[model samples]
Target: MTRSARRTRRTTRSLQVAGVSAAALLALSACSSSDDASSDSSSTPKSSSSPKLTGTVTVFAAASLKESFTSLGKEFEQAHPGTKVTFNFGGSDTLAASITGGAPADVFAAASPKTMAIVTDKKDAATTPATFVRNQLEIATLPGNPDKVSSLKDLTTSDLKVVLCDKTVPCGAAAQKALDASHLKLTPVSYEQDVKSALTKVELNEADAAVVYKTDVKAAGDKVEGVEFPESADAINDYPIALLKDAPNAEAATAFIALVQSPEGQKVLTAAGFLKPTA
Candidate 1:
């Protein structure tokens, strides 16, 4: 218990307390750093999922597919919130003309295989085409069988006053094929640019009977009556879809294509009276 020894012991005790305090501060600092790292990692979104695509997708679909394609477009937008679908639904031939003339489009859905070939031949498609659906000619009459049109041969009965899609149109081509198969010649009073316009003519009571797609007649539902003819089997035109070569929103376009081919899409298409390619 000498004064020098007492002073030395006090200084040693102070050094020990300081060391403990420093160690405790270091432990707290380490814990804070670990929490910060964990917070950062948790805040970050996962990267191993499908990328979110935000852009506009323009589709040039066949005129006959208007109803079904429109339904599919709405479903697509619902599934992908940050996407917009702009559709240019028209005659496949007209669509081909527009696209070949340099119109911008994300995807092309042609009613005819020939028109799709025109697109692919020009290298306008980014991928191989996929046949999505098929359609054939149906006799669309104005509110019941006003013409009592039962068969293809019946169309040429002189008083039927039928309107038909132009030879350039898929429906018209199918009608021609059907007529050719039956060895019957139909001299329609007028040739329409598309099945829709032809159906519209019948719906408006302008034409007695017009040939259009089964899907188109289904969409008309009560506006016109569709009569299935046996000749339809001879001229089924397949619908093909593909991404455009100069697509701006390719990811969305591709997703839209897959969605149309998906079960949900097939259901929509089928419900709208579109026959599946396989079916």
Candidate 2:
């Protein structure tokens, strides 16, 4: 071959080799970048999946939540070492007012959506409230049902002394709804501030009967007897829960809320006679 042709051929071979080297470097660089991106994506979920919760979580809940929530709080404390759960149980409206008044609560579990709306409307809730459970009204009579109160109408008898929750509270509102649904106009001996108080009147025999939550009657054990009435279905109260907007322990609050919505939490609530929330 001619010398010029040989030189040209060698130059061409050198150029081809340089091109191949450049392409291989680009492929390696792209593969490294792609691997790094995949690794980052996979790790992102691990960091956010489970929150590390610590510190004290203060929860303001409805009076009706006293029993089940206390049990659930203990379970939460047991599951999260170094974390504490403090509770303030009262009427839903009262608790909502307290939260809106800057009570510095970490969470709020209300007995009714209407009461929860008071806080949410004030922008005191961190997230939209979720209905966690339901409750029904029942006639709580003296032990052994001495008055023989079989239904809501039976409470209207002139001789029977009936107590009811005040109109401001969820239980009271439910009781009034049930009464209205049945077209029964019975005057209660006294309108208590909360369901527990109404049930207490029956338990103490101060009132022969009371319209209170089924859960309250159940929690009272042998102190009072529960009589379910069909009208109660119309006044079923939906319980809702939410994390407070200015929570002192946000992580712990979130964890507590998650625990309460879990299957184990449902078991505890249902065992206490609270109806499960229907999806």
Clash number for candidate 2: 0
lDDT of 1 at 62: 90
lDDT of 1 by residue, 1-279 (tens): 999999999999999999999999999999999999999999999879888877899999999888888988998898899999999988898998888789999999999999888888888899999998887678888897876788778889988789999999888888999989999988888999988888888888888889888988889989988888998988999999999999999999999999999999989988988888975
Q: After superposition, how far is residue 52 of candidate 1 from its true place, in Å?
A: 1.4
For each candidate in the order shown, give its overall lDDT on alpha carbons.
0.89, 0.91
Please give the lDDT score at residue 264 for candidate 2. Answer: 97
- For model 1 the local lDDT of residue 163 reads 92
lDDT of 2: 0.91
The C-alpha stretches of model 2 lying farther than 4 A from their native spots are: 1-51
RMSD of each: 4.9, 6.9
- Mark the 10 consecutive residues where model 2 has the least summed lDDT: 44-53
lDDT score, candidate 1, position 52: 88
- What TM-score does candidate 2 get on C-alpha atoms? 0.82
